[model samples]
Target: MALLDTSRTAPGKGVAPLRSAAKAALEASGLPGRKTEAWRFTSVRDLTTADATPAQGGLVVDAAPGVDVHRLQGELPADVAGWLAAVEPTLPNAHFVALNGVLADELVVLHAQGHVVAPVTVTHHGAGEGSVSTPRLLVVLEPNAELTLVERFGGSSKGLTNAVTQVRLGANAGLRHIRVHDVAQASLIGALGVAQERDSRYRSLVVSLGGRLARLDLRVRLEGAGSRCDLDGLYHVDGQDHVDHHLRVEHHAPHATSTQTYRGVLDGRGVAVFDGQAQVTRTGPGAEAHQQNRNLLLSEGARAHTKPHLEIDHDEVVASHGATVGSLDEDALFYLRARGVPREDARTILVHAFLRELLESAPTPLRDELAAALRERLPRGEVTAAMELALDVDEAKGDGIEGDA
Candidate 1:
C-alpha cells in the first residue's frame, strides 16, 4: 500500500480532528526524498515501496507507583491533544508522525508528579509480515518532579515500525530517558521531541542495536532560562543494516545549556549517518552548546557520514561542534597483539574501547546490557582473555582503567 494513502483508514475514537489534519499534512508533504535537506543522507525508499497494512501492536507498560498511565479512548489529555495538534503541521519531515495520526487507534500518556525512584518501562513487540505499527507516547512531568523512563522497540523482519514520543517538562522538573531499538530485521522510523521549561533538565541516552533500516529524529528545545539538555547516543550496525541519527538542539532562552555526544560502530556493509545542529538564538545570549560525533568503521565496505553544525545568532553564546569518522587505532591493536592477544581478539578489544566512553554515561544495568550487545556484533574471539590483557597494558602506562576493558 502507498504510505500516504489514507483512503483505507479512518480516524479512531477521540482523534478525528487530528487525523483529518494529519491526513491533509501528509498529502501536502508526501514522502521526503533525498533532495530534502533533512533526509539528505537517509533514504525512504523502503517506506515508499512497502506494502504493509496498518496494524495495532500491544504495549507493555511497567509504571512506577507515583506515575500515571492513561490510554486515550475518548478524548486525549488537554495538553497532549494540543501538542499533537501543534506539531503535526510544523515538525520537519513529519510524514511518519502524520501517518501515525491517520492510523493509530489510541495514544499512551505517562504523567509524573513527584520524585519517582523506580523507572517506567514501555516495550513494543514486532508486528507480522506486511504490517505497519505506529505507536504514540506522550510524557508529562510536573514542576519539581523527577522520573526515569525506558523504551524498547523490536519487530519482525518483514514488518515496519513507525513511532513518535513527545515530552513536556515543567519548570524545575527533570527526566532521564533511555531508549533501545533492537529490531533485527524490521525497519524503524522514530522521532523524539522534547520541550523544557525554566530550570528543567532532560538527559537522554539512545542505543540502537539492530534494524534493516533505522532512523531517529531527535529535537530538543530549551524554552526557559537555566533549562538544560544532554543527548548521548550509541549505535552498532552490520550486515547491510542502515542507521541514521538527526539531532537538533535549540537554545531559546538565556542561560540555557545543551550538549550532544554520539558514537557508532559499523562493520560489513553497514551504513551510518549523523547530522547534528546546535542553534543559539538571539534571545539565548548566555547559552552554552557543544556537540561531537565519532564513528568507527570496522570493515572496508562500511560507510559513515557525519556532520556537526552550529548556528549562533548572539555574540555572548558559547558553542562548538565537531565530528570524526575513522577506523580503529592501529597502535592500540598492535599493543594488544604484542601482549599475546590474537588478531581477532585484539580488534574486539579496540572496538569495545572506542564505544566505552559513551556507555559510561548509561545506567549500570543498561551499560552491561549494551556492552554485551556490542560484543555480540564484533568479530568473535577470546574477548574475556583479550580484555584482561588490554587492561594490563593500560595499567603498565599507569592509567586507571574504567568500563569493560
Candidate 2:
C-alpha cells in the first residue's frame, strides 16, 4: 500500500526521524481500509493517497468565543508538565502540520492546585492560500483534580486541518472534555486518543458544525473499576460537506460503565455517518454499555448512515446498541402549517429543536455559548421563521379555553 511505502512517500525534510516513526506507527496500527469493519463507513485512502508529508502553513494564537483558557495558562502539576515535555518532541511529525490551523507549539499548559471549575478554550485560525495545519495537545489531570477543557477549530481559508490530541487522566482524576469543530467551508480531519487510570472519569462532548470534510476518531479505555465514561456528539452539515464520526469504548476492568449518544442533521447534498462500537472483554464481567445514534435529513438529496455495534465477550455484561436515520416528521410539519406557520419556518423550528436536545445536555455556560454560535450560522430567513413560529406556538398553547365555552 502507498501508506506503507514510508521511505519514498514521506514528505519534507528536517523531520525525517518523526516521519519515520509515524510510518512505523501507521504500519503497526494497520491501514484504515474498506475491509476493516471499523472503517467501513469512512475511507482513509485520502490520507495515504500520496506519500505522507509535513503540511506547510502559519500558526496563530487568538481568542474564540465560547472557549475559555485561563486554567491552561496557570501553574501545572509536575507529572503533567513532565508528560507535556515528553510529548512535545513528537509534535513536528503530526499529520495536522499540513493544514493552516493551530500548531502544537502554541499549546499553553497550566497546573491545577486542587479541583478546578474554570474551563480552557483553544482556538485555531487560518489565512492566505489554503494549507494543511495540525494542532497537538497533551493534558494531564492530577490526582483528585477536576477541570473542563474545550478545544475549538475554525479557519478562514480553503484547506485541510488534521489534528491529534492525547490526554492522560491521573488516578482518581475527573475531566470534562468539550470539543467544537467549527471549521470554515474548509476541511478538517481530527483523531483523538485518550488513556484513563483507576477511578477516573473522562467525559467528552463533540460538536461538528463546519468543515467541507470532517472526521473524528475517539478511542477511550477504562483501565480501572468504577471508572465511568460519557460520550456525546452533535453534528450539522449543509452544502456539499461530509461528516463522519467513529467511536470505540473499551472496558478493560470489571464494573466499568459507559454511555454514548450521537445526533446529526444533514442538509443540501451533505452526507453524515455515525459508527459506534462498545467492546467488553472477558475480564470485564460486570461491565455495562449502551449506545444510541439518531439523525435527521432536511432535503431529499441529503443522506445519513448510522451503525451501532457491540462486541461482548463477557456473558455477565449488559450491552445494547441501536441507530435511526430519517427525515423530518411529516405529520408534525403539517400540524405547524395548519396553524399558520410557514413551511420553511416549520422545518427550521423542528430541525433546531431536534439539535437543541444535544446542546441542552451540555454544561450551562457551554450550552449557552454554543446556542449563540449556532444561531449566527443559521440562514437568516430560517432563523427568523423559527423564532416567529415558536412565538406563535407559545401564544396558541397559552390561550387555553378562550373560545372553548
Candidate 3:
C-alpha cells in the first residue's frame, strides 16, 4: 500500500493542508511487504496506525528537562527565515499533522551563517488530554557552514506524537543532530524524513527511553560527491512498550560514505526492532557504506529483531552489514558474582557494558545527559552492577592499568 492511501482519512477539525500532505506521504510510503528484504524481520502494520489526531494547544507541562527551547530561537540565523518562507510552499501539507501530542504553537528554523559552536535545543511537552501532537521544523545549512541541533521530547500526556523535520544541507556544510525521546509510557510516536547535500556531513544520534509504542524513520540521500553521513540510535524498552528504528541511506553520488549503528535493550514482554538498509547505485563508484544493529533481551519474554542490509551496484565500493540478538552472558555473570559483586549489581554491570559502545561514540555533553537519564529510568538494583563495572572500566583506563600485564 502507498503512504498516501494510509494517511487519507479525514483529519480532526481545523486540519491544515500541510497536515493532510503529511498523511498522504505516510500513506504513499506505507509499510514494506513480506517481499521487501529490508522489512522482513519487523512488520509495518503495527506502525502505520491512523488513530492519531491533532493535539489541542493547551496541555500543561510540569517541567521541561534537558531542553532549552530559547536556545533554538537564539540560534536561528536571518537567512533561515527566508529559506523557510521559500520551502514552506513546496512542502506537502501532510508534514504538519500531529499524531499524539499537541503541536507547538510556533515553528523554529535555524539557518547556518558560518560555524555554530553552541548547540540549539527544542523541547516538546504534553499535558491535558492524551492526544497526538505534530511538531514541524525546517533547517538549512549554507555551504561550508556548521551547526548542532538537539531535540528533546518529554511529557506526562498519554497519547501519540508524530513529528516531521525537513532539512537541507548545502554543499560542504556539516550538521550534528541529536534527539532524545522520553515520553510517558502511554504515548506513541512516529518521526519521518531528513535529506542531505553533496560533500555535506549529517551525523545523528537518537535515544528513546519512554513510550508505549515508538517508530522512527530516517531517509537520507547523499546528493553530492564526497558527502558523508552517520546515523546512531539507542533505545531501552521495558514493560509492554515497543520501539522500532528504520533507516535508509541512499548514495546518489560517487565517493560518498555512510555509516549506521542502532542498539536496543528490551525487558519484560517488550519488543524492539531495527531495520537498516544502505543502497549504493552504479553512479556511486568508490562509495563506502557500513551498517550494524545489536540488541539485548534482558528477560525470558523479551524479544528483539534486527536486520541490516546493503545493496552495492558499484564493484569498487566497500560495504558490510551485521546484526546480533542475545541475552546476558551467564559465564560473565558468574565471574562477577564469584568476585564478590552482588548478583543484582553484576547483572546491572553487564547490561551497562553491553550498551556502552553506543554511548562512548555519542557527543560528550549528550553522552553525559543520556547517562543521567538512563540512571533514573533503569531499575535501581537491577542496574547497579553495570554501573559499578562501568566505573571500574573508567578508572582502569584513567589509571593506565593493563588487564593482561
| Cα-based lDDT for every prediction | 0.81, 0.66, 0.65
lDDT of 1: 0.81
Candidate order by lDDT, decreasing, is 1, 2, 3
Q: Model 1: how far is 212 from its true place, Å?
A: 0.5
TM-score of 2: 0.76
- Poorest 10 consecutive residues of model 1 by lDDT? 84-93
Model 3: per-residue Cα lDDT over 140-249, one tens digit each:
77788787877777766455555656667888988888888787553544454555667899998888884666667677778789999999988888887777787888
Q: Which stretches of candidate 1 lie over 4 Å from their true place?
A: 10-14, 82-92, 381-405
Write down the TM-score of every candidate: 0.91, 0.76, 0.76
Clashes (candidate 3): 30
Tell me how far the alpha carbon of residue 248 in candidate 1 is from the true structure, in angstroms, after superposition. Answer: 0.8
State the lDDT of candidate 1 residue by residue for 71-154, as single tens digits. 885556677777565434224447777887777777888989999989899997756677777787888898999999999988
lDDT of 2: 0.66
